[model samples]
Target chain A: MDTNQPRWQRRKDARPAEIIEAALTLFVDKGFAATRLDDVATQAGVTKGTVYLYFANKEELFKAVVRETILPNIESGEHLLADHQGTWAELLWILLERWADRMEYSASTGISKLMIAEASNFPDLARFYVEEVVMRSRKLFATVIQRGIDAGEFRPVDPVMATRAVISPLMLIKVWKQSFSLCDTEPVDLKAFARFHYELMMQGLASR
Target chain B: MDTNQPRWQRRKDARPAEIIEAALTLFVDKGFAATRLDDVATQAGVTKGTVYLYFANKEELFKAVVRETILPNIESGEHLLADHQGTWAELLWILLERWADRMEYSASTGISKLMIAEASNFPDLARFYVEEVVMRSRKLFATVIQRGIDAGEFRPVDPVMATRAVISPLMLIKVWKQSFSLCDTEPVDLKAFARFHYELMMQGLASR
Candidate 1:
């Protein structure tokens, strides 16, 4: 490969996202306190100095990693709500399926593990996540649950609490798969778990 | 206060539990790497050297703290199941209430936070917790769910998965409260949340 463009310029263009990806992996693998920036830089295929050029510090890089990975996907929930025209139960299922699909690839899984692990120590990061991610997603699902109730598609239930009920098992399964799989001797079938949740959900929410 | 007896014997008698409690508080307050033995000692009202006498190091102390606080509670659950006779749903709700009550005051809450936060870095600790706490509890609940199906008290579903479904929300909420309350401006009404879940669960598990 010929170098028409300067090294610094090419590195700068490629580094932010690559670095964020690396940072996410390292942070998730090692607790925030234990992770070293040098490791993140090596994971990114860049120099530690290069990472500093893009991100001011480890905390800034962490915030950037989160925003880059999670926030973008999070906003789509609202749009999914707006664009979908279906039964609320169907919409709810679709949303959870979509999330599970994304979780398969996204750094949000790491972010989630990180949040549960470190939220108490890092209030600012935790607050940002709660506001930007948790509250927004809860609102999105709450709207769907409320719509379902209004349409008589679901048995009357507290939209907020019921949404959480619908969400918790799925979320917990994902988190468990990410965090505790090391100790889990048996492999979990993600598809079947989702399906079982859906079938039970159908019965649970049915207006009957 | 007069110490007629030698101080070493007095500390020997009282110190181990106090040190464990202090370690639990500090480990939860600061992530493990950030927590200092000095801080734990100060919290426990002991000397750092005294902590060493009882606990070889931080990790050992952490495990001991877990054993002291959670393992004791963990065994009682199996006993509770052995002693309980009622509807399966009724038994399930009772177990959850007992857990929630324990979570409110127990060091297990902090130990849980620590485990999730640091599990990757400390696989041995995680494995011990998974074996001693998680599996045993899962076994007890799985038995109840299976009995419900066998007796036709609840609808048919994979008892293991169904038990997980029942457990995930309650467990996640407790972990969230333990780990993320700093960022949570709106305090969760634990009782209301549990009540809503129980009602939805009644539907979810009811015989079709």
Candidate 2:
């Protein structure tokens, strides 16, 4: 590994990435307000000056972490729509299950909780999350619903409304997990819940 | 006002309530950690020692506010369920609309945001909210669903699952109000959304 690296190559981009990774962990653990730049430097095993060289302030560093780490996961979720060739209900289920899987990780939960706590004070961060992450994801789901309505695979539902119905249940799982702190020890059985929710959403209260 | 006051009427309970009311206003404006007891005293037109005479610390004062102001709202909500006799859908709509109204209030938003920021460190507060507030509400809603199922008004859906379905869409409103700071200027058109949501929840994606 040493033989492959030139002295110039070693100093290029690795330090910034390392600093961000360390800062993310600290921010999640102690929260953004509580965690300081010196703490990030200590966690990253770098000098305060070196950390400052990469990022100007704690807010800037935190934003970079959000952009770098969180945004990529959302970007990758776009791929779920590409292979969606099944019935709208089938596609909705698959997408919801995929979303639940993504949400199951600790890093995602930590970031989400941190965002909820801080988003009020920092409107720009909240806007970035809504526009970049939430609206985009909802748009993808809405497109599938629109296709379903056009094809007569499902009822003549408002695609936007239907999209919210399909998405909201999965979204509430995060609220449920955090609010009640249920399923802390065990996994939430999200697949079972997803299937049940999908069935309830598809069929009306009136018996066929 | 002073001339009308009896010696027994002007008591400790009166002063404590006045202090709590002032503290709630300050805490809502400046946040829990940011608002000092001195500010509360000034707002109440009392000395700081007088404020301390009623409550031991900031946490106790906040708990008192939650117990007095917020918890009563939940109790009145329960009474709403008891007072009204309607179809499950109608009852559910009423309950959700009331919740949306509360979320739209600025003071409620401030207190809830403060709670989210502090809940990680103050797990007892979180647990109290879940057990006292959320679980009771869920159970009440679930009972309404069960009654609907028994009356053959709804299809044979699992009442617990149906309750989750009914509540899930409203979560979007709460998240939008709190996390994104939307729906603050005016009343959210919850009835329209509720109608749209409940229709899809009952009948599903199939076009009639």
Candidate 3:
């Protein structure tokens, strides 16, 4: 709805985002191997040829979908860490809260679940994700954790290992939402779970 | 190895275990939908008919594989909790250590990975796993946590949510081993990871 730009130019710019959105949904619903570019095109209301104009193949589209949808959350989390004037524990809590909020509502959250399910069949893509997304995300966390230690706000636990402890429950929640929680008559209270986990983590990390 | 029994009788008794093992490997390798009875029989060194005699179908065979291999670990863990007179922290650490040790050496560890990947395709199987394995496993952790709380050894966190915090890293490690870690030149040290996580959890849960 940006009338400032020429209609054709605006449409051209919007197409890739639309395609990525469509592809993300399909990849999450169907495993990565089973999702086709044609299905993504149809879902995006673009022709199959249009999908190719943006992405060379399904694999590229999948990667693009991940980068466009999931990586921004990490970027913003970094921004929160950089801009905040808060206690390390409070910053960690806020970061977890923001993450849990996004995960509660985002279709992109299913990407991790999809990747876990299909990564075995696509080792190259898996490696790309581990290097690009997983490692970078862990670094973002490790940075905050290290900051906490340097400030003498936290115990000097190994930041690398502590990062795993912090993020693993979040990762599990995402996967569970897509898989087993689908079948649960009384599904997990994700908000309560996240809050409790954050409290426990901060308590453990607190310097005596 | 037992000479007290007839060789044929012993062989007949061993066939089900062999079939379960074969089915588990196939399920982890090829996934449930793609694995066939004939292939499993071949892996077990039995006829397809012999597999059929032990298990009515693929679902039954998969369930038996889970129950036969994974449940005994849980049972033994339960026994540890029941017999332990140690501090709750020590008991929790031992449970995690035992669980991690089993995961390090067991092919059945792959069952959770296989289930996570294939669960959406087989909802009934997923539901069965959640109700049987997932819930049971959580209950085992919760019981220990509750005992700790009642004995004034730990803080009063909700046992179920705390249980998720305890188990999520273990679940993430299992899935990671099957998926992303396949490409890692430097694989995780499972023992060190488990040790750090246990230390953190107990520290967090300890009452002042």
TM-score, per-candidate, Cα-based: 0.88, 0.82, 0.96
Tens-digit lDDT string for candidate 1 (A161-191) = 8778888887776667666779976556766
User: How far does residue B35 in candidate 1 sit from its true spot (Å)?
Assistant: 4.2
> On residues B134-157, what C-alpha lDDT tens digit does candidate 3 reach at each position?
888889999999999999999998
Interface RMSD of each: 1.5, 3.8, 1.1
Q: After superposition, how far is residue B108 of candidate 3 from its true place, in Å?
A: 0.8
Docking quality of model 1: it rates as medium
Predict model 1's lDDT versus the native: 0.80
Worst 10 residues of 1 chain B by lDDT: B105-114
Candidates sorted by DockQ, best first: 3, 1, 2
The most accurate candidate by DockQ is: 3
Candidate order, lDDT descending: 3, 1, 2
**Candidate 2 residue spans exceeding 4 A from truth:** A1-3, A6-13, A175-188, A204-208, B1-17, B155-158, B182-188, B204-208
Q: Scoring each candidate complex against the real one, what DockQ results?
A: 0.60, 0.42, 0.76
Off by over 4 Å in 3: A1-9, B1-7
User: Model 1 chain A: which ten-residue window has the lowest total lDDT?
Assistant: A185-194
* Tens-digit per-residue lDDT, B1-208, candidate 2: 4756786578654888888889878876566778899999999988999878889987788888878877787788778778877777677767776776776563554566556556666777666665666667678888877777777777776666667777877765665556665413323465666677877665642223
Can you list the residue pairs that collide in candidate 2? A155-B205, A155-B206, A155-B207, A202-B204, A204-B202, A204-B203, A205-B202
User: What level of docking quality does candidate 2 show?
Assistant: acceptable
